[model samples]
Target: REVELRLEQANHARQEAAAALGAVMERRRMLEDRLRVVRGELQSTVVRPVDPAHVMRLQVIEDQSVQALKVVRTHLGTLRDRQRALRREAGDAGARLATARTRLEELRNAAEIARQEISAVAVEIAELRVRGESVAEGLRRDADASVEEALEVPRPDVDEDLESLLASHEAELRRLGPVNPLAAQEYRDLQERYDFLAAQLDDLSSSRAELRKVIAALDERIVEEFTAAFQEVARYFEEYFGVLFPGGKGRLRLVDGSDPLTSGVEVEAMPLGKKVSRLSLLSGGERSLAALAFLFSVFRARPGPFYVLDEVEAALDDANLRRFLRLVDRFRERAQLLIVTHQQQTMEVADILYGVTLERGGSSQVLSRRIRERSQPA
Candidate 1:
């Protein structure tokens, strides 16, 4: 009985190995067929093979892009520094301008007071002259004398308090402070400086407005590009979802429609024959398929040279695995796909195979095979 059991186990192992080999052979045949079709298409279009210099040109372009990005970052730093300096200067200029205006006003007030005092003094001197002329005319008329004799008449004595009054006036003049000799010239200088600062402030204001306009334009452009890309991905998601889950509905909507640049995307999926409204409500396999559909949608929207997928169909059953393979096959001609999976169906769609195994007390070993190069079954 033990010998029979051992034989059964050995047979089972052999069968599993044979199945794996058959899967690899099937993958090889599919790749061969695809290669032939691609060649025929290329010949019909008269398209030449890929140029070896293409990679070198791409590398040069990438290097140039890096240099350009560095230059832009440096220029942005310089602009920020200049903006800070201008803000400091604007504050200083404004404070200085206010002080100059206040000084100019004080000078003007002092000038006006001095002019009033001088006018009053002139009026008093004119009155005194008129009184003296009147007294001389009276003496000439009363004495009936000649012009020279009028001067000989005796005049009244001067007021005894005249010296005291003159002393009082001198004291009052001393009470008023001495004026600034350079006040007028200093006022003119302040006015010129204020005009210059005002012009500078206007220029800074205009520059700020231009910067704001540029920022607004950049924001608008970002919104436009993001919305367009989002819409494309959403459309592709819906189409791919239908293929993966027949009769299913899928959609992507922005969390904030008014601001696409900062908004979040919401994914909604419903598998066939299910009324599910939330992703958490779906089974593990259903969620996996939905996620794959969304992922491939993005891939189609922005294709790269190659993609690496690791066990993406681990939760999928045989039917769903076939659907996943179909989706991958659609991209076969456009880009290279490297799939790492344990599923026999998934492995049966590859053009190359890589296997890893561990030896008893040694290290891990990696085995590689070109599936399309195999001539016969193992």
Candidate 2:
């Protein structure tokens, strides 16, 4: 019985050992999977071994870089301060230059006034010299002798006091009347002003001549352009008018044939069986058609990328509307046309349609639809 109990205990211990071994095997498998995932990640990553010497070197480099950054910041601040100082110096220089210019102008004005005064004094001196010469000539003529003898009269022995001499000079000055001291200066000023005005007048006269020539040239150019355009549009107008109203004669006449620049235009339209001297004499539809013909004639003469016509054919009848639509058809391949109208016939000929409609909530919405191509009459 003792041996059996010992054998049973041995068997239980072997079973526990087997279970532990299985658990260890499972744990090894999980570890192997985790290792494989880590190896894959390690293959993609770049790993460098960290050395104490390299770490120390990088720390030194960072310190140097911080120092260099500080130096550069200091240099930048110094440069900014220099720039501000330079700007201030430049401003001071500009102010000094302006003040110098103002002072120079004032000096120039003073010099001009001084020069004018000097000229007036010189003129007065010349007049006095001329009078002295005339008096000397008169004395020579009256004495009937040489000029030396005429002035050789000896003075009597008398005491000519300084006060008496000054009084006599003052009395002579008083007899000369109110002498204008600024007469010569005023004359110089007037002369300069007259010269300036004369120059201005000459410039004005030349400008007037140039302006007249320009006007003549412009008038000529206008006549040439107007004549050529009128002839081309008139031809197109005749062609379109015949198309709109078969067997009708239409013409555009200038009210003043002599001058196309300032002339008004008159439209004469004669329908197939009627004679109309003026546009107003035609019926409403006929008048609209005639106007469209003229407008399209102008369009033909001057081609453009697109055209906008707002209710142009609103007064046209069905027959005239067809003619107008046919006219619009001729320009479709060359340009885009935007027509605003309530006519279904007009919309039927369009390549696109845009309409505004109200939704159930009373909000407005814009809708766009492309139209199908329709066969056009040649």
For this target, which candidate reaches the highest lDDT against the unseen true structure? 1
Give model 2's TM-score versus the native structure: 0.50
- Alpha-carbon TM-score of each model against the true structure: 0.57, 0.50
lDDT of 1 by residue, 1-378 (tens): 232233334334334433433443344344335434423322231112122232122223323333433443344444445445544554555565567568667766755765665565556556655776676788678866665675565543543244445555556556656766775675566556546544554554465455445445544654565566568778998998888888889987877788654455566888878887577788777777777776677667767666677677877888888888888877666677777778988777777889999988889999987767433221
25 in model 2: Cα distance from truth in Å?
Answer: 99
Which parts of model 2 are misplaced by more than 4 Å? 1-186, 374-378
Give me the candidate number with maximum TM-score: 1
Clashing pairs in 1: none
Clashes of 1: 0
lDDT of 2 by residue, 1-378 (tens): 232233334334334433433443344344335434423432221212222232123223323433433443343344344334433433443454445446555655655655565565556556655765666688788867666764464422322343344455456545544545564454455345334433433443353344345434534654675578678878998999988988889988877889664455667899899865676787878877887777677667766666677777887889999998988887666666778789999998887888999999889999988887544311
Steric collisions counted per model: 0, 0
Give the Cα error of residue 209 in candidate 1, in Å: 1.5
